[model samples]
Target: MDIQKIRRDTIGCEQLIHLNNAGAALMPAVVANGIRDYISAEETGGGYETADKYSAELDQFYTYMAKLLHCRSENIAFTTNATDSFNRALSAVPFKQGDVILTTENDYPSNFIAFISLQKRLGIEIVTVRNTPSGETDLEDLEQKINTLQPRLVSVTHVPTSSGLVQPVAAIGNITKRYDTLYLLDACQSVGQLAVDAIATGADFISGTFRKFLRGPRGAGFLYISDKALQSGLEPLFPDLRGAEWTGIHAYTHREDAKRFEDWETAFALMAGSTAAIKYLLDIGIQEVQTRNETLTAYLRHQLGNVPGVQLQDKGKHPCSIVTFSIANQEPERFKQYFKQHGVNIYTTARSSAIIDFTQKGIEWVARVSPHYYNTEAEIDRFMQLLTAIA
Candidate 1:
């Protein structure tokens, strides 16, 4: 990869040592410009007119995402963010009283909260699978739970937000397939950073956000509904006109495709921006992006380990770019503020973000520093020096 050329295309590379990619990545100039051009057109013309004019670009969001995820364009639905996408996918599952939704202890917080809500409202049981000693989803235990419980849905976060732990989704998919259970995957942190094949992963429903590793504008996310999911006739709770046609005074027909999960009104500019950002990543190739991300993060982990008082806290059999660690004697807020004041961008994850995982690991909070493909080794070294001094 041409790291120099890629960095040049990124807007904040020169101004800040951006290591908060897991929170929100720095958007590329192409994506920013694409959004700007669309917004400009909207201001010059009208919202509907601009949307009609750039309809192809807006539609390209599905095409690009389909190509990136190895699925049909008809299977994609654009959403406001990852949480919304996940919620839409979850709402489609036919949950009844005493139904089981099996997942990992380290699953994303918002998703777990949704499960809790379901448990309260519908008497659905939220069953958490055991994790391995090394902090990965225990496949053996997961299979056993599936065999015994016959869960209504088996959900897994491809990469949890609070840690760099990557769950074995494909392996879990294999188990879910054997049990004939629906599999939902949250790929918010892994979509652009890794090459994800939706079908190969056996994910009936997958959700992702463009604001993170995809380097796209905020307010843009997507959900992928498999052919099997479409055939299942699963419908989200609330379907707008875009998702369902008002055929009669009290009746409507849901869309045959994944659009049944979408809202009528959307940010066309954000959609255009997502299209450009995904196209840019496709041009670079996901394989190459994954390689660069692993290389840079490996360097980051090695350098961070060398710093005294910096306890490396990532726990996955195959960790990627989202690096988490804690200062030996400093508070998470203070450490985050100190790093920000020193022109090093970073964020912190608290126990609330990963209650089960953090409690199990005996951590109150930790700093999360994520590096993208555009970040350089020198930037990693500079951040390391800052962290060393703080330690």
Candidate 2:
């Protein structure tokens, strides 16, 4: 990779040391310009006419996503964000009053809240799979739970937002596949940071966003539905005209593809930006990005470990680019403010973000520093110097 060119392509590198990729990445110039160009096109022509004119570009959104996910284009559906994708995918699964939904302690907050709502409204049971000693999803415990509970759906987050803890989705998939249970994998944090294969992961539904490590515009995400899920006649709880054809007075036929989960209106500019971001990643190669990111993460981890009063909080067998830690006597808000003042960007993860894990670990909150591949070693050194002075 041309490190200089990569930094040049990212406009923020010159002014800020952005380590908050988990929150939202620095959008590339290509993506931003593409979105602006699309908006200009829409204004020049009519709204509907512009959409028709850009039909090929809009369709490439699916093609690009399919390439990133290693899935068929027909299986992908656009959404406003990862939360939207997850909600839509979850609603498609028929949950009964007494059905069980299995999930992990490290699942995203929005999904956890959705599960609670389902429990209250439908009386569905939410079972949590305990983590192992290393703080990963326990495969043995998960297998036992699958056999005993016969869960209606097995949900797991590919990577938790709070830390570098990456769950073993493939192993979990093995158990879910054996039991013939439906599986939903939240890949919002994992999709762009690492290479993912829908078939190898064995997730019936995978939800993700392009705004994070994908470096695309916000308000754009997607859901990947497996061929089996489509064949099973799974339909969204509320189908709009875009997703279904109204046949009679009270009858409608939902589309067979994953687009059935999509609504009528969409942000075409954002979609165009998302397509450009995917194409950029594909051209550079995900494997290369992953390797570079791992190197940067290792350097940051080593430097942070050496700083006095700093405690590394991330735990996983194979942690990704996300690095979480806490300063000895600094409030999270103050810490964030100090960094912001220094032209550094980082975020904090509250206990409520992952209640079960945070409670078990006795942590109220922690600062998260996530660096992408475009970041330089010199930048990491500068960050360490700033942190040491603060300490």
Candidate 3:
């Protein structure tokens, strides 16, 4: 990977350090320009006319996403964000009273709330599988749960937002497959940063965002639906005209493919930007990106670990690019402001943000520094210098 060329293409590289990629990465020139050009065209030619003209480009977004996800174009549906994509996929599952959603403790907080909502609205049961000492999903406990009590769906987050903990997703997928149960994998953090194959992951539904490692603009994401899921007649409970066609007064037939998960209207400019971002990653190659990320993260962990009063908070057998740590005797807001003052980008994750995991770890909050492959080792060194002076 050409660090110079990568940093040059990223507009903010020279101005400040960006260590909050897991929150949102620096968008490259290709993605920004694509969005700007499309929006400009829409402003002059009108939205409808511009969309009609760039119909092929808009359609090609799905094709690019299909390549990234290892799925067919028909199985991809564009959503607003990872939450929207996950919600759509969750709603599609035909859950009745007493249905169970077996998940892990480190599942996304938003997803956990969604599951709780299901429990309140419907009589759905939410069961959590055991976590290993290192905070990864325990395959033994998961298999035992599936064997003893059947779950309607096995949902797991590929990477938790609170830390660098990488869940054993593929193994969980295998467990779900054994029971012939539905599986939903939250690949929002894993997709662009980590190489994720839908078929290999064995997830019936995969939800992701382009704004993170993919470096696309916000307000745009995509969902992947497996052939078996679609063939089994699963679709979003709230279907719009874009997803289905009305046949009679109160009857409608949803599309056979993943379009049934999307709404009618879409932000074409964002779609254009997302397409360009995915194309950029594909050109660079995800495997190469992963290699670069591993080196950066390893260096970060080592440097941060040695910093006085800095406690490394991330845990997993194989952690990804996200690096979370708590500074003793430092307020989270203070930590956030200190980095901001130094022209560094990072986020402070609160215990409320991830109650289960945070409460278990006994920390009120932690500062998150998520770096991408585009970042330089020199930047990490400077990051350490600034952090060492934090006391």
lDDT of 3 by residue, 1-391 (tens): 8889988999999899999999999999999999999999998999999999999999999899989888899999999999999999999888999999999888898999999999999999999998899999999999999887798899999999999999877778877887868999999989899998888888999999888988999999999999999999998989999999999998999999899999889998999999999999999999999999999999989888787888889989889999999888898887888988999989999997788898899999989999999998899888888889975
Clashing pairs in 1: none
lDDT, model 1:
0.91
lDDT of 1 at 287: 99
Worst ten in a row by lDDT for model 1: 382-391
Task: Please report, in order, the local distance difference test score of every candidate based on alpha carbons.
Answer: 0.91, 0.92, 0.91
**TM-score per candidate, chains pooled:** 0.98, 0.99, 0.98
lDDT of 1 by residue, 1-391 (tens): 8999999998698888899999999999999999999999999999999999988778888898999999999999999999999999999898899999999998899999999999999999999999888889889999999999999999899999888988888888888988768899999999999899999999999999999999998899999999999988987889999999999999999999999999989998999999999999999999999999999999999888888777888898899889998778888788888988988899999999999988877989989999999998999988888877767
State the lDDT of candidate 2 residue by residue for 1-391, as single tens digits: 8889988999988889998888899988999999999999989997789899999989999998999888999999999999999999899889889999999999999999999999999999999999888899999999998899899999999999999999988888887998968999999999888999998999999999988999988899989999999999987899899999999998999999999999989899999999999999998899999999999999999999898899999999889999998788889898999989999998999998988888988889999999998888988887888899988
- Name the Cα RMSD for model 3: 1.0
Report the C-alpha displacement of residue 23, candidate 3, in angstroms: 0.4
List the candidate 2 regions with Cα displacement exceeding 4 Å: none
Question: What does candidate 2 score on TM?
Answer: 0.99
